[model samples]
Target: MDTVYSVVGLGKLGASMAAAIASRGFRVIGVDINRRAVEAVNAGQAPVQETGLEELIAANQKRLRATLDHHEAVLNSDVTFVVVPTPSDERGAFSLQYAAWAFRKIGYALKEKKGYHLVVLTSTVLPGSTRYGLLPILEKESGKRCGVDFGLCYSPEFIALGSVIRDFLNPDFTLIGEYDEKSGSLLESTYARILENNAPCYRMSFENAELAKIAVNTFVTMKITFANMLADLCERIPGGNIDAVTQALGADQRIGPKYLKGSLGYGGPCFPRDNIALSFFARAVDTAAELAETTDRINRALPAKIVEQLKPFFHKGATVAVLGLAYKPFSHVVEESQGIYLAKTLADIGFRVVGYDPLAAEPARIELRDQAVVLDSLEECLNQAEVVIIATPDPVFRRLTLADLQDRNVETVVDCWRILEKELKGHSIRYITIGQNINDEESQARLIKLWGNTDANSDT
Candidate 1:
C-alpha cells in the first residue's frame, strides 16, 4: 500500500481536504471526535453540503476512510494536515483550546510513531502562536528536535463554504510558511499538481503567514465597511442609488469591482472572528488598529439598523418574512450572520419572523429555533407576512417575480442586496431597501419633506 496523508478533523474543511488529497491518488484517513461525522465520510456521505462534495467523496471512497482514533491515523500516515477548529472567545480573543487540544493529541500520537513525517498546521492562529505554543509541545511530547526528526509548517486553508471542493482542487494561491525550504518542498510536492497550474505561491515565516490570513480578512472587512457607509449616505439622498454609484466606482481601473456592493455586514465563521482576533493581536504589541475596530462596530450596528427600520412597519402581532438566512450567499453556515441576528431582534420585538433559505433552512432552524420559524418554502412563509425582508442575496431568491409576492399579504419589501428593484417598481408595491431609494409614495414624500431636496445625484 502507498503511504497515506491523514486529516485530523472531519468537518467541512477537513472532510473536503481528505477527499481532495485522496482524489489526487493518495490514501487519506480522516479523524474526528464525532463518530457520526467520521462514519458519514467513510460511508460516502458528506457531513456538510458543498457544490461537488458527494461526487468527490464517491470517487475517492476506496482511498479514503475515517476513524475517531487519532493514534491510529497518525501512526498510519506519512503526512498529516491539522485542520481543526479555532473559534473566538466571548471577549473576542482567539481561543486556542480547540486547536491546542488537537495539537496536543497529535503530539502524543507522534511520540509512539517512528518516521520522518511532516505535520502542517492548516488552522488560523494568531501570529507567533505556532512557534510559541504548538512547536514547543510537539518537541516536548515526541522527545525529538523539530526539523531534524520531523518537519513542521503552517499552510492555512482558505476555502469558501459552498465551494470548498473546487477551492481545494484549484486554489487561487498557496501560502506555505515553513521552518526551512526542505520542509516546504515536501509539503509543496504533496500539492505538486496544484502548484503546476502556476497559482501564486507565497513563502513566508510562520508569524507572517498567520498575520497574512488576518490581514486579508481585515482588508475585506474594511471594504465592506466602506460600502456600508456609502449605503447609509445613499439612503439619505433623494434619488441616489448606492449600488449604482458603487458599480460606477468599480468600473474605475483603480477600484476594480468585487466586494463593493453594500449589504448586511460580513459575518460567518471566519471574517468577524478573524477581524476581532487581529485587533486583539495588535493590542498586545501596544499598537491598536483603529480602522479594524471601526469596521467591527459598523458591522455589528448594521443588523440593529435593519431592525429599527422594520419596527415602524410592524403592526401589533404582525408577521414578517425573512428570506435567505445564511451568513452569506449559498452556505448553510449562520455563525455571526446578520440574518440570524436580525431574526432574533425582530422576534424579540414581537414580530413573528419566518425565515427561508435554499440550503440553510434546516441549519438555520436549529440555530434559531427559539428566535424565529425557519420555513422550507418561500411561498408559504410570505403568505401572511406584513413585510418581506430579503436578508441574503441567494441567486435563487433573485429569480422571484413581483407576481409571486403579489399573492402574499406583504405590504412592503426590504431588499437588502438591491435585488428585485425593477420588479418591485413594476408592481408599484411599497418597498424599502438599504443602499437604494424608497419606493413607497408616502414614505418618499415624507423623506423629501423632512430632509428637503439636496443633490439627489451624488455619483460624481
Candidate 2:
C-alpha cells in the first residue's frame, strides 16, 4: 500500500539518498554496477566516504538493501531514481552515456513488470537531455507508452558532498520535472512523506527543470564571483573590509547573505562544470553568456592571482606549505579544488611546495604526484615551510596558535579566509589577510593620487 523506492548508482549522492529514505521508515533497494558498492551496502556499511553516511546506513539496514540486479530492483520497487554520474565531456557538456546505459537497463526491467512504475532521473544534465536524449531509450526498450503504461520524471537533488544526508532530507525546496500530471503528482506525494522539512515542490516540464538546476548553480557562482571581486576592491581601498561591506549588502532583502563570503573561488564536482556547461549551451543557442563565461574565467584565475600576490614573499628554493587541499573545510573531495590548484601552481614555479589536508591528503597526493609533496600531518607541513597559506578555513587550522608558527621559523603567512588575523597579527611573521588592506600608508597614498587631496581647512 506504500511506495517502495529503488535508487540506481550507489555513489555518494545515491547511497546517501537511499539511506535517508530508508531511515524515514520506507523500503529502499539500491542498484549499482560496482560489486563492492553493492556488497558494502548489503553489509550495512557506506559505499563511499561521506559524513554520517555509514551510521545512517547501519541504523536503517532492515529497510535498505543493495543489489547488482537492476531487474530485481525495478520489479520490486514502485519508483526508480537514476543517480548515475553524467560526467562532463571534452565539449563542456554533460555526457549522458552512463545515464543512457542505466535507463536502458531500467527500461528492459519495465518491459517485464506488469504494473505502473515511475522512473525519476536525479542526475545533472543539460536542458533537452532528459526528454530528447534519454526518454526515447526508455520507450524503445520497454515497448511501452509513457504516461500510460509508465511514467518519467527529472528530479535532481541540490546537495553538497560532505552534507548530502542533511541537505537531501531538508532541502529549501524540491524541483520536479514531469512527463505528465500523473507522474508529477506521484513524486510530489512521495516527497511529502520523505522530507523532514515541509519543503515546497516546483514542478514543470523536463527541459525547464533541467535548465533551472544548472541556472541555480551558475547564479550562485556569479554571486560568489561578485563577493570575490569585492574582496579584490577591498584590498585596494584604504580601511576597506570585505566582511563589513558584504554584511551591509546582505542586509538588503534582495541580496540575502548566502554564499556571499569573500573567500576562495568555488571548486567542487558541480559549480565549475555547471557554469561552463551553461556557457556552452548559450553558444549553441546563439546567445551570449558573457557573465557566466567571465565568472568561470575569474574563478579559474584565482589560484594564479593568489600566487602572484605571494610571489613577493617567496625566496629562491623556499619551502611553501599549503593548508587544506580540499576545496572547502571538512571535505575530502579535491575535484577542481583551489587549494590543490594553488599547490600545483606554486610547485610549477619552482617553489618547494608541500600540501596538507585533514582528510584529503591521500587524494591530493595522487593529484599532485611529483609536483608537490602532500604531507600527512599538519605539523609536518608547517615544520618545513618558510611561507604558509591557509587556503580553507578548516577548524583545525583556526585553532593554530603562536607556538605553531613561531617554532617553524616561518617568514610569511597568507590567510586567504582571514581566519587567523587576530591570533597571527602583530607576531614576528608577516601576516597578510586577502580581503583586508595590508598597508594603509600605501593605499592612502594611491587614494590621494587618484583624487587631489582637499584638506578640511582648505575648501575648494
Candidate 3:
C-alpha cells in the first residue's frame, strides 16, 4: 500500500502538493504553522488562487486535511514532503534557519514514531544541503544511523507559482536525488502513482539534485537576460521590435520558444534568489560564476529600464499607475517582483506611482510600503494616473476591453505584456507597450478610444 503523504508548509508548493497527492488517491495531510492557511485547507479551500485548484481540493477533500501541529503531521504520514520557505536575509544571505528548524521538527517527530519514515525535501537549497546542512541535524535529533533507520532525499520541486498545481500534476520530468538507494526506491514508489506519464525520474546523489535545480533556474535566468538584452537594443533602433526578433529566433529548432518574452526582467521568489544563492554557494567554494554574475547584473537593471521608458513622458509631478504587481499572471506572490521595484524607482524619481493588482494588492502594499499608493479598483488607479503601465498580463486583466478602459477614464495605456494595443488602436489614448513600435498617431488613436470616447460605450 502507498504510504500516507504529509506536506509540511501549506504555502503555494506545499498546498498544491498536498492537493495533488490526494487527487492521486493517496491519504494526504496538509500542515502549516500559519493558522489561516491551515484553516483554509481544512475547510476544503485553497490558500492561494490557482487554476483548477479549488475544484481539485473539492474533489479530494476527504483524502486531504490540514493541521497546525507538526508532530501529528509527522507521525501520521509515512513520507513527509518539506516545502518550507528559505528566503534570503536583509544582507542577501540564504537564511538556513527555516530549513534547519523544519528539519529538527521532522527529525524529533520521527524519533517518536515507530514505523519506517521517509523525508523528501522539495525546497531549493545550496549544494551540500543534504549532507552538510540537514543530514547531521537529522541524525543528531533522531539518534539513528542515516540509511538504516530512515530515508531522505533532496528532491527539489520544479514548479512556477502561477502554474504550480498544473506543473506538479504534469511536470516535464522529475528529479529525485537520494542519499541512498532506500530513499530513492521509497520516493520512486510514491511518485509512480502521481507521475502517471512515467516521466523520466533521474536519481542521483543529493549534491547533483541540488545543483540540477540551481542549473535549471540559472539557465532560465540567462535566457530571459538574453532576451532583455535584445530588448534594450531594440528600444534604441528604429522599427526594432524585440518581440519580432524573439519570435523569429524561436522558429529555429534549437531555440524552440519558452521564456523568451522580454519584460521588466525575471522576478518571483525563485529565480533571482536562487540565482544569487547558487552564486554564493559557488563563491564559497572558490569558484565564482562570471556568467551567473552577468545574468544577475542584466536582471537587476530591469527596474531602471522601466524608469527610462517613463522618461519620455516625465512631466513635472506626473502620476503613473502601475497595474499588476505580481511577478507573473495568476499568482499573488511578489517576492523580488520587478513591478514593485519599478514602482519604487519611479516614485523615487519624483513620479507619483499608484499600484493595483487583482490579487497582490496587500502583498504589494506590504512590499512597497509608503513608496507607492495601492488603489482598490483598476478604474480608480487609471483615473488618478497620467500613464498606466500593465506589468502583469493576468488573463483577467488581458481580457479587458476598450469599453472598460474608457469607462474607467484611463488616459495613457502602457502595456508591458504587449496586450490591448491592437484592440484599442482606434482610441485616442496613447498606447505604449514593450517591444512594440508605437508612433504618436497610434498613441493618440489609443487615447481617443480610451479617454475621448465619453459618449460611446462598447462601440469600439
Candidate 4:
C-alpha cells in the first residue's frame, strides 16, 4: 500500500478507479487533460456522474488528488494506470488515438524518472493494440528498453459505468498482460493488497489478454442475443413464457443464467460496439466472425421490429409513454440505449411519445430533441399517455399497480419484461407481453392446421 498509484483520464472509469483505490488505504494521483475534471477531483468531488462516485471521492479526500501534468503523476507514483478512451472508429475497430497520446506523455515522464515504473493500460482495445500500436510509442518517447528500464502492462477493467466502484473493488478476476514476468508480478501483488475480494489474476502475453478482454464482452452479447432470439420465437408459440424458458436454460450448468432475461436486446456504450469491433477484428486476420456479425445485426434491428409488431396495438397519433429511457436501471447514460431507439422509432411512426427515467431525463431529452417529450416526472409521463411501453426493467416500473395504470382512458399496456402481468392481466385495459402469445386460441388453431388436424380434440 506504500506504492502510490496514478490513474490517467478522469472519466467515469478512471475517476472511480482513483477514488476506489484511495479508499483502500493507498495514495492515488488522478490525471486528466480536462481542467474541470482535475479541479473537481482536487477539491474532493467527482467530475463525472456515477452511482456513489461523488460520495466515494468525498470520503477519500485525504489520500486522493488530481493533476493535469503526466510528469507529476508518473514521477510520484509507482504504477500509472491509463484509462483513456479507445472509441470505435468507422471500421468498428477501437481507435488508439487517445491511448497513444497518453502513452507518449507517460513515456516522456519515464525518461526523466530513474526507477522501475509499471505503466498499465486499463482501456479496452482490440488484440495487438497494446503490443503493436501503443508499446512502440512508449519505448520511442522514453528512449529506453521496455523490460530493462521500466515495465509495461495491458490490464483492462471489466466494469460497467453505473457500478464501477463496486465492481472494481470486487472483480471476479484481474487480467494482467505483461511485458515481462516482473511487470505482471507487480500488478498481481498490487491487486492482492488493494482489491477487497481477493480475486484471482489471469496473466498472459499482451495480445492474448487484449483478445480475451474483448472476447469476454462479445461472448456475453452473443448469449444475450440467443435469449432474445428465443423471446422472438416464444411470441409465436401458444402460452410461451420467456421467463420460464430462461429459468430452465439458466439451470443448465453451462449457461449459468446471467443476461438471459430474454426481453430487450442488449444495448449500451460497450455491448453494442464490442460485438462489431470483435467482428471487425476477426475479419482483419483472415477469420470469419458470422456469430458476432449476426448478433450485431439482430440486436440493431430489434427496436424497429418490436415497434412494427406493436403497430396494431397503437392507434394513429395516440399518446405513448416510454418508461425507463436509460440503457439499464440505476444509470443516467443514454448512449446506444434501446429505450431511446424505441422512443425515436415510435415517434417516427406518428405516436406522440413521452419518455421518463428517474435519472436520465435530461440526456434522453437532449438525444430525443423534438422526437419525444422527455418528462420531468414519471407521473406526468403516465398521466398524458393513452398507451404505454415499458422499455427498461427499472424497479419503479416494476412497482406499478393495476390502479396506477387503469384510468379507463389508457387503452393498452405492452410490458416488455412482463413486470405488470399479474396486476393487469384480467383488467379492463388490454395487456400484452413481448415474449408471450396474445391470442392463445388463435395460435393453437394455427398450429393444429399446420399439422393437418381435422378435429379440434385431435393432438398433433
TM, every model: 0.91, 0.98, 0.88, 0.97
lDDT, residue 288, model 3: 84
- Candidate 3 has what TM-score? 0.88
Ten contiguous residues minimizing lDDT sum, candidate 4: 451-460
lDDT of 4 by residue, 266-365 (tens): 8778999998899899899999789999999999999999999999888899999999899999999899899999999999988899999999999998
Q: State each model's CA lDDT, in order.
A: 0.83, 0.94, 0.83, 0.92
Model 1: runs farther than 4 Å from truth?
Answer: 1-3, 194-196, 310-316, 439-460
- RMSD value for candidate 3: 8.9
> After superposition on all CA atoms, what RMSD does each candidate show versus the true structure?
4.0, 1.6, 8.9, 2.1
**For candidate 3, which ten residues in a row score worst on lDDT?**
436-445
What TM-score does candidate 1 get on C-alpha atoms? 0.91
Residue lDDT tens for model 2, 195-286: 99999999999999999999999999999999999998899888888999999999999999999889789999999999889999999889
Best by lDDT: 2
Extract clashing residue pairs from model 2: none
Give the winner by lDDT: 2 or 3.
2
Sort by lDDT, best first: 2, 4, 1, 3
Winner of 3 and 4 under TM-score? 4
- Minimum summed lDDT over a 10-residue window in model 2 is located at 451-460
Question: Which of 1 and 3 is the better model by TM-score?
Answer: 1
